[model samples]
Target chain A: MDAVLEADGLGKRYGNRWALRDCTFSLPEGQVAALVGPNGAGKSTLLHLAVGLLRPDDGSVRVLGQQPYDNVAVLPDLGFVAQDTPLYRDFTAAELVTMGGKLNRARWDASVARNRLAQLGIAPHQRVGTLSGGQRAQVALALALSKRPRLLLLDEPVASLDPLARHEFLQALMGSVAETGTTVLLSSHLLSDLERVCDHLVLLETAKVRLTGSVDDLLGTHRQLIGARHDGSAIPGVAAVIRESHTDRQSTLLVRVDGWVDETRWTSTEVGLEDLILGYLGDHRRQGSHAAWGVTA
Target chain B: MVIEFVLDGRSKVNTYMQLVQQVRQALRVGLLESGDQLPKVRDVAQALAINPNTVLKAYRQLEMEGLAEGRPGVGTFVTGTLAGASLMHQAELRADLVGWLRRAQTAGLTADDIVALVDTTIRATLADDVIVVTHT
Candidate 1:
């Protein structure tokens, strides 16, 4: 499969602290991959490295099979919307789209951006700063899509917007993806929102890549078992125990299973993306030891 | 009216599975029938603000199950039904079930308790088919 983004042994540091370390993952093209983790977990750092904002300290990063930073060819194919949705406050929405057209030499469709803003009910003549957070986001997204980039990278674009605005923004985004088949990698703390929009997931924890896989594959392979209290060692066909909790009478275990289990003794139930991601995040917090579980990158 | 699909993202069920089950349930209840057009993938994706690929996957699963078919340049249409009994028979059964449910509610049975009772009874009836044998 052609990967939209790939990283191998990627690491970044600020002063003595490492923001991201040994993060290696590949996202297949045409997938809306979610970059998720708690704060200070390097979600921003990874996205920055991919879009050429920051250079890696240890290993290589590739976007569309080419180095991102300072590469003219790769830069044209990438569109980035930062956390702030940075735009010239004084510029009208129309002027911003015009500026985006002038900036990208490869391909620019001014009407696409203009039409997008119009559809969002954002007046073309209104100053960007005067627009609400959501409208500002739509303008930023319009500018990005105007360039016709093959890959779009977003960093918490909806964190400040209200619920309705968030819905409108995502609806516009999904419509764009449906039309152009653009591969998107968006970093967000909103797990439920991610659950709605992302097909692939990359979970970071304490500056390391903890989990990365398609949402369907991940959910299908992991199971939640509710059974009588006993040592979990005897559970057959288990890959790794992601989380476990118990009472005197019964035990609940979240395990990644490679094959079928005896369903009669233990009620094996499927897990959703949020539960699967939370189980991994919670396990990392409770144990503080990834080594004990033997989770491979 | 077309059957409206709702997905609970927080539930243990996968989103695609939820969609597939909803379509099947709609078919069983006679809300959706053969030749009925399902919503376009993009329309559902935008309406629900979900990933388009998720909608595609669910539609594909439905196609695989022979419950729906997608025609190129056209929309997906329901091609099969889960309705086993005649419509009149099913309607009569549903009416009786509703009456019983009302009586159960008056008897102070919560919705959860009613579901649990029905689920346990169904499982017990199905368990009779499993014949465990021991080798001497």
Candidate 2:
């Protein structure tokens, strides 16, 4: 099967400013991928392009083996919950679900939506405007899941939710993915949340992709070395120096390893997901350039 | 069955590694034994709110380490034990070790110092065995 989402040289511009430029990444099917980046790094722009909310100015994007926009068959297979989870304020939970069923036609599963709402403790008669933020988000998620989408694109769905609510929402989401094998591409600035749920990662910065890969593979290939740092010129297997800091007596280097290094020289420690992401983000910020650390593209 | 998996997301340790370590630790403490079925991947994933793939990877790692095995259409099961001694013997040894650790703590040894001491002792014993073999 092709990737769930694929982008090649994807770029999007607004007037003179480039919201996203030269972005390219392929998210494999059945993987929960975390799309993370700093504010204004085009995270949302990339997601918008993927879901066909906006078109790319330069390159092309494919969602589930077809162009996202204007494709009759593809639209039903793609579910999108925008950042605010835009829902009709006056519509009750049941009405919103009915609307979803009407909008999706044969594709919508009203029973699934209604059951999810009831399980989430959302009363069917309650107006969306009167629901709590978490309840509203749950209703939005129910609508999305009711479509039975093969690919679900979430944009900071839990950014405003409290910790417990966030946990509950993710629990529900993962349950659906497990049951239905839904491919999730969730964009969030919260690294901790991503760390818990994401097996794949894509890091964006300055409107470009800094890194993307399986989290396990990335963590296995990166190492933190704290020892006498002497320019790192003699390190034979260092793929890239992701980040480097020095003191008068010692040097710390975060390096992507392509092969074995002389372990006797430094204490090599394992790198975690958050540390790896922060290292790339910090490097991009300090250098103000897209230095692809371990990213071939 | 129904292993209560705990994950420390904030720790520097990789989550999968943490899972692998937990399974091994459980075996060592007799909490899990041979023929004990591990939770289904989806069940653990939903319970922890983590990706099912992560749970699958951890289970695969355990299988690689010869600690677990996955039966087709059936759930994964613990296949090997980490503890070398009999359960009664292990309990006695554990009690002695705990008593020794308490004494070491009372003697102003930090947790790091205790770990270092245990690690160095094990390494030194292995080195002695190697020297003995070479001389023989």
Candidate 3:
């Protein structure tokens, strides 16, 4: 599959501090990818860079095979819902749809947006400011989908909603993707939600891309192993020891494997997507980036 | 089909496997008849808030198991049924299995040891007739 988005050593800094640096990954077309990380990990920065809202200070990013910074050709094919699903509080849902139609006139499908709002029982004339958080998010999502863009970028779209609302929002998002096959990059901290809707995974830590791949492949290749305590060195046949804890008598290690492990010496168990990420994130929380420790090399 | 799939978030089982198990269960209970059309991929994805690819993967697994078949441009349909008189003995068999498990536990076998023993015995006993799918 062709990559919808690609970055190479992408970096952006604010003043003396780097918000994102040495970032690199590619999102293939037709995959709903999850952009996840700890706070201040530059998720929003990456989204902004992708949508042309901000330019990278180092290296580059490509959306639909070209630089997106002020690139009008790629803008029409890209739809973005910034954090908080922001909209004009004064305008009603209908007016917002009208504005969206005018903004993307060539590709906008008004009726689809109208039908979606109607199905959700959101009145078209209802003011955006008065709508509930979930309703506003839905309206924003409807408008984004109405544009029928080839790629959709959502930044923490469900972070503010309650669990039920989050579920409904993901349902709607998946429903639209089912129909249109629109490639989506949704940044979120909810692992369970991502497990339901996303096929691809990207983990950014301390402003760098730590891991990126298909969710199934990632889950399949990673495992949790428990065994007698051993030296904190390389284990034969294991690709990388993602994290390891040791006591005087026992060791527990989360590792990436290539269909190879010393079964006789280790009791291995498969990890779910959530645990897999938590393992990596836990390691980061303890030792910062695994890169600095050379765990991945 | 008269069945709606539900997901258990904390089950530790693969999502697609949960879906497949649900289908098998519905078939075992006679809720999904041989001719019944499975839910559309889009419908399932929307209803369950899961990726369409996951739903497609589950349906493909069903097809592989000879329990269902998909028609181009249409949807998947059940083609096999596991419902039989054996289901009538489920209660009795379950009681005996529970008793055996309790006995094994009391006799100093850990859960994993009992599972391995039962699994191996089952394989040794039904080697030619069954394909064992051990769940953790």
Candidate 4:
């Protein structure tokens, strides 16, 4: 499998503060991956690095097996949708899409763009500024997709619209990916959404990856077990007991168990992605440790 | 293509779900067809101004339910043939409805009360059906 994105010992520093440090991960072509973290968790920094928007202080980054920054040949193969989603608000949707076609050296499929916009119910003749925020977003996205890039990088792509619009937008986006085979690296704060679209998840905190793997594998390894409350002191087979909720007769625990627990007494259930994330965040807070990263079993 | 998701205006359901439900309704109504390609996930995420991941989750669930499929190298697509999903989906929907009905029963609402509530709402909606007004 060819790697669509790769990084090694990646670090970014702002004066004395470290935004990201020793970050390492690679995503192959035909893979859809998500980067997840709390606000200011260096997710944007990582994305900037991957897309060649910003250079790293140390280490290297690549997109589609080539250096991403200012590399014209590689640039045409990639598409980027930023957080602010800048657009020429004065231009009409048709004018904006046409302008994108004129700017890109690669073939810009205008008909595809027009059809996609129409399917989304966005009027091509409407002025971008007069359009609603959601409609403006659609125009910008149409411009990006028109370019038909192989690798797409997006930062907080859907942080604005109302609920129904959000669903329509995502359905459209995923539908495109399924059709065009574009590999995407998306950064987001919504774990449930990530659980829905992403096969692989990269957990970032303090500028480094804490956990990275398939959702199924992560859930399989981490189990939440509920047992009789009185024997709650410590579980003999677990790796690390992080959180515990107890009652008079029964106790539920979030524990990192070593290997597998095939025991009948323990009612085991797979921990959700959100639960695992919250546990990671909570553990980070409790250790009183900053600038340190650890992957849970 | 008969996709349906819950949308509660004031309940604890998140906004992204409302988005999901509406899309499902569109599919159910034939507003979006089997061969129709959806907008890119990022594009939709950007338009709705919600988390891309939430939208992704909805798409993924739809895929798992066989209403959608994410073709490797291609984008996500609506299933051309929904015939394969009918039996499994029927069982799943039944189980889900049973769970909800059980909760309604526990809340002290009788079946008669529920039926009466539906009847009144339907009557109010149909009251203006015979009225005609001039067009501008």
Tens-digit lDDT string for candidate 2 (A159-197)? 999998889889889888888889999999878888879
Per-candidate RMSD, Å = 6.6, 6.6, 7.4, 12.5
- On a 0 to 100 scale, what is the lDDT of residue B110 in model 3? 100
Model 1: number of backbone collisions: 0
lDDT of 4 at A3: 79
TM-score of chain B of each: 0.72, 0.66, 0.63, 0.49
Predicted candidate 4 versus true structure: per-residue lDDT over A2-53, tens digit per residue: 8788888888898988898888888766556888887888999988887787
Write candidate 2's Cα lDDT for B1-136 as tens digits: 5468988865666667788999998998889999999988877887888888778889999999999999988889999999766775887888999999999999999999999999888877977777443444
Using lDDT, give the best candidate's number.
3
Worst 10 residues of 1 chain A by lDDT: A284-293
Tens-place lDDT digits, model 3, residues A1-297? 499999999999999899999999999999999999999999999999999999999989999888999789898889999999989999998999999988897789998899999999988889999999999999999999998999999999999999999999999999989899999999999987888899999899989988999999898899999999978777877988998889999999999997678899999999878888889988856644778777873
> What TM-score does model 1 achieve against the real structure?
0.83
- lDDT, residue B117, model 4: 68
DockQ of each: 0.60, 0.57, 0.64, 0.05
Candidate ordering by lDDT (highest first): 3, 1, 2, 4
**TM-score ranking, high to low:** 3, 2, 1, 4
| Residue-level lDDT tens digits of model 4 in B21-110 | 666666654566576655556666444433455566777877776777787655677774333335447667889978977887898989
Name the top TM-score candidate: 3
Question: Which residue pairs in candidate 1 collide?
Answer: none
The per-model lDDT (C-alpha) reads 0.89, 0.88, 0.91, 0.72
CA shift at A146, candidate 4, in angstroms? 1.5
Per-candidate TM-scores read 0.83, 0.84, 0.85, 0.66
